[model samples]
Target: MDSFEQLIGKNINEVDLNESKTFFIALLEYDTKHCGKRYPSSKYKLADMDYYDLISFSQLFKKEAILIVWYNMDIITDLEIYYLSNDFDILFNDYYIIKKAIDNGLAHKLTEGDTKYLGASRLNEKVPQPHSDILANKREFVLKKKYLQKIIDEISFSCK
Candidate 1:
């Protein structure tokens, strides 16, 4: 198993997570075509469930995990690893907003701009949402593209 896969399900320390983040970042090829640009296309939507697992792990363990941002089927344009000041409260708040939206049958209206950090992005499937009979497009929580771009700009600037 890879070092990252090994860290899964284990109580990872900050240092170890940071090491993994750094290694993952190093492997990414800066996407000049998409990074710092407007949203590419729906085709770029993240289709990997493993990333959702990592997001869940980050919230449950209060540790950072690398989230690769795919701009399309073939290109991964950016990555994000956030460390919130009050991780639990902020995460809970974002969760609350998303849940409420879904419960109100407004899942179709949920957009990347709804929450501060986390967004309920559309998935490829349509599914029944909780507390509502509407067959809303399945959604997954993701780091907002704008937020990821900001992080990318920061990282790029720092590297200069």
Candidate 2:
């Protein structure tokens, strides 16, 4: 696998899940009305999930974790995510846009799908004027022994 460090203009690959002492997951709900558009928090809800599979995985590998769930639309920073993942030793964000990051192979496509996660009306809330910082919502759950299942779930559930 190509080290995401090089893609992010970093000299070394720092994506070591084992080294992560803390794991953070940010979830941002999308607005159904803004489907296929920039998902702003104005018309969406934001909340945090108590636990996710990544946390357990990190713990299994002797890593501490923390997951954060935010609502609405927020910019997806690919480089930041890649670095954060490795730095934190946990894969929290970037699953949805991993392909884009891999295909782009450059740091310029960071904002390609800024609003791709929008149109998710699971929350069903609409605000005409949304806050500018509301970016993306992440939904995560826990997994037992099936570690690979997490990737499969992301590809099937979030990547779709």
Candidate 3:
């Protein structure tokens, strides 16, 4: 569906998970929009998993649409989780959203339901360096702020 770039813009620098220590895990469960035909991927399997593995596994299975994990980046990025899976080679994380629905609350509320693990991704690893995460977070916050201001200006002009 929507790439992070489309939703949040590419103004934010992609964090180097290999270096950052604060990590967030986004668990994903794809909704089946078609009739029959099970996907080549599993819904909720938690084994030693990591960001890169998510990237690789998605490429292999090609069934999962979005990788949904928790938004706790301060704790889960340094892990190479796929090492624990029976077939770690089949995981991937393309077009994933790092932010959580909790950030959206209300209409965009994060369901902390039991179905979370069922369609949720686990954030079990952390970025190796917290400093890296800090930089990424700052960049994202600033970019969003600027985007909001631009939208406000456009609306004001239209009303005038």
Candidate 4:
């Protein structure tokens, strides 16, 4: 199986979201028992090492389809798939600002509070940023947690 990073330039439809979700869930389950004490700081025993790559890849599509896997006490509980129409005028503007900031060497300064919907979030301190001239931590665009919660709330409300 190709790493999520390898799927960056591919069309969104070409990547099987269900397969990826299944793989991650299995990985988490296995890692929970065997990889004890490996990640002391993580609330969940397992962390997807490719999460930043996955989010970056998702941003390339106009219709960003994300699979949200819910967990309770480290056990998989539910899964919800949501699509963000990135081509909307406001979303496009936000994306453009984020891209411009990165291209302008401000990636290191980007914070989650910088945008209402989307944000450029730091991935790792040592990861090298390709677009910035200044040496900076690698960053990936992500939907703000608050914004994600709002979406989840709406979905939950509608389902009732």
TM-score of each: 0.49, 0.18, 0.18, 0.51
Model 1 off-target regions past 4 Å? 1-29, 33-61, 65-92, 156-160
Tens digits of per-residue lDDT for model 2, 1-160: 4433444354322222233345433232333242333222322212222211222323322433324232332323211121223323232332334323323332222332332221111222322211223323333222211222232233333321
lDDT by residue (31-95, candidate 3, tens digit) is 22255221212233322222222323333233322222211222221222221122222122111
lDDT tens readout by residue for model 4, 26-141? 11111222433111111111122122233332334434455555433444445666555533455566666766666565666766676676666666654544455565665555
* TM value for model 4: 0.51
Model 4: CA > 4 A from native: 1-59, 86-90, 126-133, 157-160
Better of 1 and 4 by lDDT: 1
Candidate 2 segments whose C-alpha is farther than 4 A from its true place: 1-6, 9-14, 24-61, 66-75, 78-160
Q: What is the number of backbone collisions in each predicted candidate, taken in the order shown?
A: 2, 24, 38, 0
Runs in model 3 deviating more than 4 A are 1-43, 46-49, 52-95, 98-120, 123-125, 129-131, 134-160
Model 1 poorest 10 in a row by lDDT: 43-52
Shift in Å, residue 158, candidate 2? 12
Candidate number with the higher TM-score (1 or 3): 1
Give the lDDT of residue 74 in candidate 2.
34
C-alpha lDDT of candidate 1 relative to the true structure? 0.48
lDDT of 3: 0.25
Ranking by TM-score: 4, 1, 3, 2
